[model samples]
Target: MKRSGNPSARDTKEGLVGWVEAKRKPIGTRPLRIKNTSRRRRDMINRKSSLGVALAIYLAFCALPGIAAEPDVNSLPKERQQQWDKIKSGMEQEYNVCIEHCGGKSECEQKCRQAHESRLQREFLKLQTAEAVPAANDTDLVHWRKTSGTGEQE
Candidate 1:
C-alpha cells in the first residue's frame, strides 16, 4: 500500500516490486564481521610507540650538534636537480620572451609577467584535467602569442 496523499509514492504492485528489486542486494554477498576489539589497547600501544620514536630522535639530535633540524632544498638528488633545471629553463624562457616584448618598460614588463603567469597556470589547469601539454616544438613566444578563436575565454 502507498503512503496516504503522497503523489510520488509507489502505488501499483509493479511499482512496489520495482522498489523492492532496487533495494535488494545480491545473494551470498554478506559483509565481513572482523573482530575489531581492543581499540583502546591498540591506541595506547600506538601512542607509546610514537613517544618512544620521538624520544629516540631527540636523543640522537642532542648527541649531534652539527646535524640540521630540517632538510635543505639544495641537497636534493642530482636527478631531481636536473628535473628542476628543466622546469626553471621553461619558465625562464617564457619570462625572457615577456621581457623582450616589454622592451625595458617597467609597466609593460609587469603586465607581461601577469599575462605569462596566468597563461602558465591555465596550461597547468588544462593538464590537470588530463589534457596533453602544448607541442614541445612550439616556442613559448609562438604559443603564448596565439590568439584564441573566441574573443574571450569562458
Candidate 2:
C-alpha cells in the first residue's frame, strides 16, 4: 500500500485526551445549574424576602397620617364664623321641627319647607343691608334700606 507523509503522533494523542476530559465533566456542574439542595434553599430564601418586602410596604402605607387631619374652623374670620354658626343653628332648629311635623303628617312638609326658605331669605336680606350700610348713622342706614327694598320689589 502507498503511504502518505507521516502525521505527528503526539498531537493526535493530546487532542484525544482533551476530548475525553471535556466529556467526563457533569453537565449540571455548570454555573447556571445549581445542585438539588442548593436550588431548594435559594427558592425558600427568595420567597421569604419577597413576602417580607410586601409586608413592610403594606405597614408603611397604613402608618401614614392621610386620614387623621381635622379641619380648622377657627381659621375663618370671626364675623363670618359667627354668621355661619347662626345660620347653621337656625337650619338645625328648622330641620328638627320639620322632622317632627313630617313624622306626624307628611302632607305638611312642603308648607314647612316654604316657610323655612322665606325666613332664611329675609335673614339673608337683613345681613346684606347691614353689610351695605357704611356706618351706623341714620342717613346711610335709611338710604341702604330704601335701596334694598326697591331692589327686592323689582
Candidate 3:
C-alpha cells in the first residue's frame, strides 16, 4: 500500500506529538484572516477621521459668531440706527450727570457709572422685548420703563 504525505495521516501514525506539530504554523508566518480584518480596521479608521473632520468644521462654524467683530451700527437700517443713537445719547446724558454730581470723588463717580450702566441695560432689554413682542401691552413695557425713571407708560 502507498502512504499519503497528508499531515492527518502522519498524525494517526505519530500520535499526539505529530498532531500538535501539524497544527502549529511556521515562524514568521501570519494567518490569512489578518489581511481582511486589517483592511476593515483601516476603513473604519478612515470613516472615523472623516467624521472627526466634519465635526471640527461644524464646531468652527458655530464658534464664528463669538469670534467675529462687533456689528457696525452705521450699516443698520434708519429706525435701528435711531434707536442706537437714542441709547448713546442717553448714556452721554448719564455720564454728564455723573460727572457733575460726583465732582472729584472717584468712588461716587464709579457708583453713578454703575447705576447708569444698569439703567442702560434695562433700557436695552425694554427695547428688545418691546420690538420682539409687538403685541406686548403697555403695562409690560411700563414695568421696564418704571425702573428706568421714566414714569410715562406710553
Which pairs of residues collide in model 2?
none
TM-score of each model, paired residue for residue? 0.27, 0.31, 0.35
lDDT string, candidate 2, 1-154, tens digits: 2223333222353353222324545664433333665877867776787799899999888865443332244755577558856985787698778868687675687677656666765655455445533455555666675676654211
lDDT tens string, model 1, 14-109?
A: 555334434655554533223564767666766787799899999998966533222233655565556545654687798999899778999999
How would the candidate models be sorted by lDDT, starting from the highest? 3, 2, 1
lDDT of model 1 at residue 4?
Answer: 57
Which candidate number has the best TM-score?
3
**What value does the lDDT take at residue 8 in candidate 2?**
29
Candidate 3, position 95, lDDT? 86
Worst 10 residues of 2 by lDDT: 1-10
What's the lDDT for candidate 3?
Answer: 0.65
The regions of model 2 sitting more than 4 angstroms off are 1-81, 131-154
- State the lDDT at 96 in candidate 2: 76
Runs in model 1 deviating more than 4 A are 1-88, 131-154
